[model samples]
Target chain A: MENLIDIKGVRHAYDTAAGKLPVLDGLEVSVKEGGFCAVVGPSGCGKSTLTRLIAGLMHPDEGEVWLHGEQVKGPRSTVGMAFQNPVLLEWRTILQNVMLPLEIVPGGLKGKAAVERAESLLALVGLEGFEDKRPSELSGGMRQRASLCRALVHQPDVLILDEPFGALDAFTREDLWQTMHEVKAKEPFTAVLITHDLRESIFLGDQVVVLSGRPARTQYVMEITRDGPPKLDDLYTPEASERLATLRHQIEIAQGRAEEGVSA
Target chain B: MTGTLRKILVPTAAMIIFLILWEALVWVMGWPNYKMASPSDLIPAYERYWELFLIMGWQTLWRTVLGLLLAIIVGTAIGMIMGFSRTMRDALYPLLVGFNAIPKATVVPIVALMFVGAHDFNTVLIAFMISFFPIAVSVSIGLSTLEPEYRDILRSLGASQTTIFWKIALPKTLPEFFGALKVSVTLAFIGTNLMEIVSPHGRGLGALFDSGKTNSDYPLMFAVLIALALLGIVLYYVVVALEKVFAGWAERQPG
Candidate 1:
């Protein structure tokens, strides 16, 4: 199977007033075709940077990023992303926000069919009747749901979620996680999610890539198994809980080193 | 009992009280009627030159409205260019700010002298000068704050620049554009009036007031001043009403 996303020893850093600060230092990770991969790390440890490299929002200072076997030269609209903040446009209604990408993309989506596509996407996220309501008029959870629809509306090959459920309450986040699982079951797509939630990473992602501290690179990759049906029943089992704990310890140790470097 | 009445009650009561005090102060101090006309005394003055005052007021209003409209159109265009292009903004913003800092009233007479026009072009020019900067600054700020998430989302979805501007930029900046206009309208009126005070062709309330002062016809001056007040109030209320109609959109806006 072709690797939908291929990142090989990518290095990136941003220019700041102080000086150049390193982010990703020779980090490599690849998402297998149709696999849900989550990169979990401390804040600013280049987990989100990996998403940008894959989505073509930013280029790696050194190294290659490939999407669907093609080298990413610049931004390709074929990747869909939702940020931690819902980022729903205030002026646009829920449905219109979801329909925006299709209008922008050269999909030739027009008239009633386009509208129906938007409606089905909105219905998929359980915001069926909220077609005419603006983002400001909706609750935080509802806004995020609308955001999911917007991400999927154009049917992009890759969907990237950067802490997508970070701002939501625990209950809402869990609910959306289940919804995402169902959505994936129906229409399988390659996704790279950057998250801090270990259980969430284990629950939704087929592969979990854990990073070292700042100036970080891929340190570990763990594969999760679902024999037949993807169910929430085994989320808190001993094996899953132990894995979650070990992931937490590794992240904490990596973070302590980063903090010490900052002080020094 | 009435919604409309409730809206105006505080301002109306305050105005009534002010008039009553003015009437008392004049009568008690033995101030001459010509020196300071009370609200009741100024009532006749409005009727005496009703036709002339109306015409002058209309001229100023036209100048103010057209000037502000022009400011929004030109300002938003320039602002969008500045907002989207970093090179343009860095090069132009400082120069624009320098222009904004210079008071229009000081330069109005010179501008009017340079332009040859039979109509109230001087007043219009003054209004435009005063309004232009505020509109430009507000629109530039509004457009610059175009949410990085917006570009990210659109880029990921394969959105082009033109579509982003029309569908995204225009609607987002709308509330702020109107807010800028609200500020611009007030300045436009002041600038036009200041020009009227100096221009050869200005027969507006400013000139009328100047004439009344020179001729020592305080009653006529007071009456014309009242008419000018009414004019300002009308223009201000018009913008306020527009904001009311667009309030739903404004409420959604982030500051």
Candidate 2:
């Protein structure tokens, strides 16, 4: 597999009223084509900023962000994103909201084709009857599902999930994780999921990258080895327990609670 | 009752009760019509001067509508410009606030003097000036406070500024826009009436009120006031109707 996204020594800072606040420092990450990269870190570790850099919504003050072997110079229509809030337009129906990117991106789907594409994605997400429903009409979980459809509707080269399921209850989050696998199996695309939940990261990601505290840098990378697709029951196994413990320890180290080469 | 019916019926019932209370008060006091004209007393005035009332009311209505339309165009343009750029907003906001702080009544005389004898134009001008501030302010707030997430979603898709404005910003701002319009329409009527009262253009309900005041015709004066209130109510409902059509999504309740 070829590398679809490569972030090399990416550094960024925000110029606040107080002064410049560094967010990302010497961060490095890469995701092969059709691979899922879950990035976990401490709170305010600049995970969201990393998503923006990948989406080309903003540029790093230093270093490079490459997508498909090309350095990102500006916003790219080939990137799709979903945030934790699932900010669907109140003015559009679920289907129409899903089709929003198609309406904006040049040479994208139009008219009946756009509607069909949106409708199909909705059906895939089990939102078939919700086509004409407004975003507010749906439950939080349903709305998030619709948002995922919206993000993928344009067939973007890269999909970025910026804590998209952070607001959901545990049950809803797990269901979405399974739905995510189902969707990815059908519609292939490289993805970067920024999450706080260790289980979520291990379940959804092939490669999990951990970052240190504020002004974050990649601290550790763990690749999950599974004989078959991930299942909820697998999370209760000893192997899964060991991986979770190790990741939890890594997070403590990242948060500066424990030093490197120390056992808890 | 259905929500829509209740919305209309409640206000209608309340108005009827209010009018009955006023009539009872007048009858109990036994004041002369010149001192206080009840709703019944205004009926004879309406019958006698029906044609005059029609012409004047039409004049006031048209002027208010015309001025409000112009205000919408100019206010939306200014608001969008201010919303899109921090420099423009910073440069223009303080000036707008200062101008809006001035009494529009005082400005009426200045406008009447500048365009002397252009009574209709002066009325429209004052209406536009008085009503545009709320619109510009509301629109600017709506745009500036737009959820950055929505913008990020569109921008990542390489959406142009114009496309974002039309698809997201404009639709999202509609609830606020209509809210401002509800306020602006009333202000427009006040502006038109203010010009008519201050400068006595002899063509609107305000002028009718002035003539009735000078002649001590209390019933006619009351009739003009009623006419203006009715017009305002009608225009208000029109805006509410438009709000339903354009931004109905904002009013939805969770299922």
Candidate 3:
């Protein structure tokens, strides 16, 4: 598989009033074309920063980020993003909010074409009739679904999700995972998901990358050998449980919460 | 009562109770009409001097409206500049604070001096001066509150600053703009009234009060007060209605 997205020796730091705070150090990642890569790390591992770097929203303090064989100098129209919070404009209806990118991206869809694209995307997320409703009127799950539609509306080459369903209940989160899987399967874009949920990472990602603590580097990378997208029932299987336990143990040691050489 | 009916009835009942208490206090105190007039005296006064009140009240209301309209344009432009540029904010914020500190009433007299014989211009200037600061400050604050996440999302989509301003910043500032308008509209009325009170040309509500005070016609003075109060209430409600129409998204809908 060809590398669709690549982050090479990237380092990022924030200049706080106190001092310079380093977040990512020599962090390298690569995703193959049409791959869904879920990045899992301990909380505060600068996972969000990585997403920003990939999306080209900001420049890295050092090193290079490449998308589709070109260096990412600035924000690209071919990159789509959804955050943990829906961040829907309160005044816009669901359909309008989903269509926001089309209006912003240069030479993007417009007028009736934009509306039709938004309508079909909404339908994919099971938000068909809720098009005219304000975000406040929608449930938390519904809002996240709408947000996903917004991110995908412009049909970008790479989709970056920063814990997109982190605020939802467990049930809703799982349901959205299935929705996301279906969307990716149908649309076939390279996806990079930053999440704290390990189970979610394995469930949705073809490849999972884990990062260590602050000033994070890639600690471990796992490729699931599953034949197809895992169903909800697969999560309850013994094989899934063993994989979960192994990942949890690795994360505990990586976060410095457990001794590396000791058995619990 | 239904929710809609209760909303209307509750405020109406409160107003009725307030009036009854005011009447009782007047009767018990036995304060002459000059000091305190009951609703009985107030209603008859309105009927007898309806023409005077209407003509003068119209003059005051139009001046207030004109002044407020000018303030909205000037203030919002200044606000957008201040909001978009850090240097502008740093340069102008202290100056605005200092200008707002000076009593607007005192400026009225200075404006009168500058204009000399132009009473209406002086009145409008005073009104503009009085209401400008609040609108500018509110709009600037609203623009500043554009969320980091929103910026990130828009930037990721390759949105330019101009697009962000029209699509994001402008709509977000509307609720704050309307809030400032409500406060500034009242200030505008005060500005118009201040000019009318001090000016020799007494053609508005302020002039009615000035003449009534000179002649010791307490009923006429009280009548003017009622008209001013009604004018303020109506204008405030108009702003409230406009806010509901334009920025209804900011309001909390009942479940």
Q: Which window of 10 residues has the lowest lDDT sum in candidate 3 chain A?
A: A255-264
Identify the superior model by DockQ, candidate 2 or candidate 3.
2
Q: Native-contact fraction for each model? A: 0.78, 0.98, 0.87
Model 3 ranges off by over 4 Å? A258-264, B1-21, B43-49, B86-94
lDDT of 1 by residue, A1-264 (tens): 888898988888889999999999979888888899988988889787787787787888999998888999888878888998888877677887888887777764777877898898788878888999888888888898888888887788999999999998998999999999888877678899989899899989999988888898887788888877766777878988877877777677678743322322
Best by DockQ: 2
Q: Clashes in model 1: which pairs?
A: none
Which is the winner by lDDT between candidate 1 and candidate 3? 3
Give the number of the best model, judged by TM-score: 2
DockQ scores of the candidates? 0.61, 0.86, 0.80
Cα lDDT of model 2 by residue, A131-153, tens digit: 99998889999999999999999
List TM-scores for all candidates, in order. 0.90, 0.97, 0.92
Question: With candidate 3 superimposed using the best TM-score fit, by how many Å does residue A234's alpha carbon deviate from the native?
Answer: 2.6
- Best candidate per lDDT, number? 2
Error of 3 at A131 (Å): 1.2
Cα lDDT over the full model 1: 0.81
User: In DockQ, how does model 1 score against the reference complex?
Assistant: 0.61
